[model samples]
Target chain A: MPKVTIDNITIDVEEGTTILNAARKIGGRIVPPAMCYYSKLKGSGGKCRTCLVKVAQSSAKDPRPMPKLVASCSTPVQDGMVVQNLTSPEVAEARKGIVEFLLLNHPLDCPVCDQAGECDLQDLSFGYGMEETATEDDRREFPVIDIGDKIKLHMNRCILCYRCVYVADQLTDKRLHGILYRGDVSEISTFIGNAVTNDFSGNMIDVCPVGALTDKTARFKSRVWFLKPMDAHRACGKCPGKVAIWMFGNEIYRVTGRKDQFGEVEEFICNECRFEKKEPGDWVIEGPRHIKRQSVISANHYEEMKKQSIIDPIAGEMNKQE
Target chain B: MKSLTNRSKVVSNKQMTFWERIYFPAILNGMRITFGHLFRRKATVQYPEATREFSDIYRGKHVLKRDDEGRERCTSCGLCAVACPAEAITMVSAERKPGEEHLYREEKYAAVYEINMLRCIFCGDCEEACPKEAIFLTKELVKSEYQREKFIYGKDELVESPDPAKRVDVSKRQTKEVLEFKKDKRYKHNK
Candidate 1:
C-alpha cells in the first residue's frame, strides 16, 4: 500500500492504483472531474485532460514536484506522493483550459440535447468553462448517424474520448466501430457504415461524456430533469438486471444502467434491458435513485422515507384507559 | 387595576341633552363626508366600457414568442416548466423533420405545449428561465372563462402570430441592461 495526499487529505491505497482512483478512495471535492475516464473499463483514461492535477511532491525518496500538471487519470500514485486538485490554482486554470478545448468543436445545442441535465461535459463546463467561446472558426459538423437501432450518434458533440471504443473492444466480442481518420479530421464511425448490433453496444451511449451518443427511443421526448430517476430491476438472463429507469409520472420514459456519483455506469446492461422494455410493470421499482443535490436532475425531485411516529406517554396511557 | 397597554377607555351610559337626543348634527356630519366622496376622483373604471393603462412589464398572459425569421423559438427544453413555482407549464417535444425546418428554430420543438392559466401565479419565473428567449409575459390579461378546462391554454392560444405585424411585443419586459446583454457579441449564445 502507498500513502497519497490529495487536496490535503491523506489516504492509503494499493501501489498499482492510479491517482484518480486514489483520489476516489478519499472521495468528495478532492476527486477530479474525469470526462473520458471510466473506472469499469480498462484503458479508458489519458484521452481527456480534464482531470489534470498538480503534483506538489513526487514521492518520499524524491520530494521534487513534477514540472507540469499531470493527467490524474493516467498518473500512478507513489508512496508519500502529495497531489493538489482544488487546492492548486494552476490545476484549476489547466482544467478550465481543458474544458475550453473539449468544447471547442462542440455544437452548443444543449437546449435540444437529451443529455443536457445529466451530461458530465455540461457539469464540467458549468463548473470550469467560460461563458464565451474564443474560437471564430466554424465547428466541424457531421451528419447524425445511428450506430445501432437504439443509439443516435451526433459526431459534432464528441470530444474524441474513445470510451465507447473501449466498451466495444472490451465488453463486446466483435468490435464493429472504431475511430476513423487522424487528428482533427478523426471521427468515431463504423467501418463502411456497418451498424453495431452487439448486445453490449448500448453501453456506449451510457459511457459517452456528452450528448454525442443518445437513446434514439427517448429522443426529443422530454428533458432528463423533467423525468424522475428510480432504482429499478427485472430478471434478465444476459447481464445484471439492476438498472435505473427514468420515469415521467407512472410511465417509464427511458432505462439506463445505474450510474454512480461520478456518472459512470456500475454494471453494463444488455440491449434488451436498455431498449424494447417500456412498460411500468416490467420491473419492480425499489425507490427514487438518489441524485446529488448540486445536479439539476435533483431539482424538485424528492422521495419520502418510511414514516416514524412517536406517541406521547400520557396520550398512550389515556388511550389505554379509554 | 392598571391597564397593561395604558390606553384603556372607560365606558359610560349618560343621559343625552335635547340637541344630542335629536341626532340631526351626527347625521348631517356623516352626510357631508359621503357627499365629499362623490365629488372626488373615482378609484375604479367600468371594466367593459372603460380601460386602465397597464404597466409596460405587467406579467399577465404568457406568449410563446417567434424569432425575427418567423420560426418558432421554443426548443422545448423544459426549463420554464421546472422554474415554474406553480408547476403550470407542461410540454411534449418532437424532433423537426427535414421539411419542417421552416416551422421550428431548433432541431427539436415543442409539439404539445400547454399552460394551466388557473394554476399560474404570473410570477414571470418562466419568462426568466427561458434560455432561448422563447417565452415571455405580455401585458395582455388572461381572459375569464366559465369552464375550468378553458383555463388550460394550448399552443394555439400561447404562440404568437406568425405575421411580424401582429407579433406580441415583450420588449418592455426586457430591461435596457438585458437588451444590451442580448446584443453583446462576446457571448457565444448571443452571436
Candidate 2:
C-alpha cells in the first residue's frame, strides 16, 4: 500500500497504482484529463504527457522532490509522496502548452466534423488551449481515408494518442493496423496496404479521442446532440451483443459499445451488434432512457457472458424474440 | 415698429407697372428653369427593359455558394442564421450519405435552408459570418411578390447553379476589407 498526499489531500492506494488512479480514488475534482491513458488497455499511458503534475516531496528513502514535473498517468504512487495538481500554477501552464501542441495540426473544420459535441479533444482544447494560435506556419494536412465500408479515418484530426492502436491490438483479436512512418509524416495505416477490417474494427472508432476515426454508417447521419441513445441488444453467435442504439426520429441510426456512468465503454461490443443487427426487432429493449449517466449502468447488463449472473429477463424475452 | 431709416422700408421700389403686374416675365423665367432640366440626364430609368447598374457593395438577395466541384459548401452549422440580425435565416443539417460527396462538400449538408426576404435587411452579416464561404449576398434583388409566403426563399431557390460557369458569382461583390481578411492562412485545413 502507498500513502500519498496530492494537493494537501492524503490518500492510500495499492502498490502498483499510478498517480492518475490515485487521483481518481481521491475522487471529486482531481483526476487530470488523460488523452492517451485508457485504463482498460495496458501500456497506453505516458505517451500523451497531458496529465503532468508536480511532486513537491517524496518518501524518506528518496528524501528529495523530483527534478521536473512528472506525467501523472505513468508515475507510480510512492509512499509519503506529495503531489500538486490543479492548484499548482506551473502544472496548469505546462498543460496549456500540451493542449496547444495537440491542436497545432488539428483542422478548424469543426463545422463539418461529426465529433463536434461529444469529442474529448474539443472539450479539452476549449478548457486549456490558447485563444489565438501563436504559430503562423502551415498546418499539416492529410487526405481522409476510408478503411473499407465501416470506418473513415481523417488523419488531420489525429493527435497520435495511440488509444485506437492499443484497443485494436490489446482489446480485440487483430493487429492488422498500426502507425506507419515517423515524425510529422506518421500515419495510421493497415499492414502492407491491406484493408483494416477485422470483426472489432468498429470499436476503434469509439476509442478514438478525435474525429480521426468515425463510424462510416453513422457519418454525416445526425449530430450526436440530436440523437437519443437507447439501451438495446440482441442474441449473438460470437461476442456480447449489449450496446447503445442511437436513434433519430423513428429510425435506428447506429449502434456502438455502451458506456457506463464514467463514459468508458463497459464491455467491448462486436461487429454483429454494431453492423448486422440494425432492425428494431433484432434487439430486446434493456432499460429506461440511456440519456443520463445514472441510467447507463442499469440499462447495460445484456452482455451475453454475464447475462445469467445479473438478472434473468431472457426467459420471457427469448419467447418474445422467437 | 418702423425701420430706423425710411429707405430700408421703401415698399416695392417705384410701383410696378400694370404690364409687370401681369407677370409674363416671371412665367417665362419659370419655363426657362423647367426646360434647363430636360436637357440634362434623365433621373428615372426605364426598368425591365434597361436595368440600372448597382454599386459594387450593394447587398441584395442571398445566394448559397457551391464549391468549384459543384458540391454545396454549407455544412449547415447555423452560423449564418445566428449572424442574421433580423433572424431571417433558418436551416436544418443532415449527414451526407455515401456516394453523395459530389453533391456536398463535407460530411454534413444543409437539408433545409431558407431566408425570409421580407424580413431580411440585406446587411450581409450572414455573408461575413460564414466560415465555409458558403453563403453570399448577391446583386440580384428580391422580386416583389403577391404573397408573404412567396417572400421566403428555400434551398431550391437559394442554391447556386451546379455548373461552375453558371454559378452565382459574388467575387465582384466583396470589398477590399473583406478580401484582406479572407487572406488569413492560419486555418489551412478549413481553407
Candidate 3:
C-alpha cells in the first residue's frame, strides 16, 4: 500500500489503484469525469478525456514531466504522488476543448429529444462548454437510419460512444454490436443492416449518456424531464438479479442497472435486467371509469345481469319474488 | 326624434367639406406609418445563402474518428453505449485479421454498428463514452433524410481521419511494446 496526497488529502491505496480510486478513497471534492468506466466490467476504457488531473512529482526517473495532467481513470496511484484536481488551467482547458470537440458533431435536437432532461451531455455542456461555436456552416449531413423493429438509429445525435457494444459483449456475454470505421467517420452498427434484436437491447437506451440511441416505443412519446421516476425493487423477469424499475406516472417505462444493489464501484446490470418487457397494463393509467349518461341505469341490462348472477342461490328466489 | 330648432321645417341635404371628402390628412398619416417601416432594417435572414452563427458549444451531428495511421480508433470497447442514455447505439465485434491490420488499429474491431437517426436525441453521451475518441458530435447539423433507411450510417460513413495537429507521435519503445503485447499469448484468443 502506498500513501498518496490528492489536493492535500493523503490516502493509502493498493499499488495498482488508479488515481480515481484513490481520490474516491480520500473523499476528495474533485469531480472525476468518467465516460467509459463501467464498475461491473474489467477494462477501465479511459476513452473520454474529461477526467484529466495534474499530479505532482510523478516518478523518480521522469522528473521533467512532473505535475503533468493525466487521465485519472488510467493513472495508477504511486507513493508520495500529489494529485491536484482543481486549480489547473490545463485541465480546465482540456475539459473545455473536449467538450467543444464533442459538440462539433452533436445535433441541436434537445428541444424534441426524449432524453433532454436526463442527458449527461446536457449537464456537461452546461457545466463545461463555451457559450458559442466557431464553425457553424460545416455541419455534417446524414439521413436517419433504422436498424430494425425495436431500435431507431439517429446518426445525427450519435457521439460514437461504444458503451452499448461493451455491455453487449463484455458484461451481458453477447456479441451484438461494433464500430465500423475510423476517426470522425466511425459509427456503431450491426451486420447485414439488421436491427438490434437482443432481449437486453432496451438497456442500451438507458445507458446511453446522450440521445443518439433511444427506444423506438418510447420515442417521441414523453420527454425525460416529464417523467417522474419511482424506485421499485423487483426480480428480473429474465435474470435472477433484483433490478431497479423506473416508473413514470404509475407506469413502468424502463429498467436500469441498480447502483445501490451493485456497489457504486461495481455497477453491473445484465442485459436481461435492462430491457423492459411490455406488460398488459404497463402504460395504462387506471383512472375512474368514464360512464356515459345514456348507458346509465338500464333495466334490461340489470335484469340480464341478475339472471346470470344467480346460479343456485337464494337470490334467485328473492328475484323471482320481486 | 325630430329637430326642434328648424325655422320652416327645412330638410337640409348637406354637402361634405373639401377636407372631409378628400381624406388627404388620414391618407398622409397612413403613408407616414408605412414609410417608417421602409427605412427599418429587415430582420429576415436569407437562408441557404446566409446562415446564423452557431454557439461555440452548439451540439450538432456526429463524427467518427480515425488514428494517426488513418486507422479506425474504435476498439469496439462499447463504453459509448454505456454512457448513452438513449441506448441508440448497437455494435458487433470481430477479431481483426492479418491483412485487415491497416483498417483497424486493435485486435478487436467493430464489425456492425448502427445508430437509429430517427430515434437519436443528439445528447453527445456516445462522444463522452467513447474511450478511443472514435466517436464525436461535430457542429454539423444538416441531417435530413428522404428515406429512413438512408439515415442509418455504417462504419464506412462514420470513421474519420485523425487531425494532424491533435495526433501524438508514439515513441519507438511504446510502439514496440504495443506490437509485443499484440503478439503476446494473452491476446491469442482475440486474434
- Which pairs clash inside model 1? none
True contacts kept of 2: 0.58
Question: Model 3 residue A274 lDDT?
Answer: 50
lDDT of 2 by residue, A86-197 (tens): 9899988998999888888888878888776667787778878887777787778887878767888899899898888988887667687889899888988777657766
Complex DockQ per candidate: 0.71, 0.26, 0.01
Query: Where does model 1 exceed 4 Å of error?
Result: A304-322, B1-32, B181-191
lDDT of each model, Cα atoms only? 0.90, 0.79, 0.61
Scored by DockQ, the top model is 1
Candidate 3 Cα outliers beyond 4 Å, as residue runs = A59-68, A259-322, B1-191
Predicted structure 2, TM vs. truth: 0.69
lDDT of 3 by residue, A1-322 (tens): 7777777777788999998878766552464655555445566447767678887667444444464578887788777777777666777787888788777888655544556655667767877789666664554547666665656677777776676676667645456667888887888777767666665565566556677777666655433333333333345456444444444445656654443211231244445445544342432222221111222111112122345436756765444332
The digit string of per-residue lDDT tens for model 2 on B1-191 reads: 78777667555668888988999998999999999998999998898898999887679888888877788899987667666788898777887779998999876799999999989998989988887888988888899989999999999899988876788767787777667766774554235
Which is better, 1 or 2, measured by TM-score? 1
lDDT of 3 by residue, B78-126 (tens): 5565556676776665656679888887645778777766667888788
In model 2 chain A, the worst 10-residue window by lDDT is: A293-302
TM-score of chain A of each: 0.94, 0.86, 0.76
Top model number, lDDT: 1
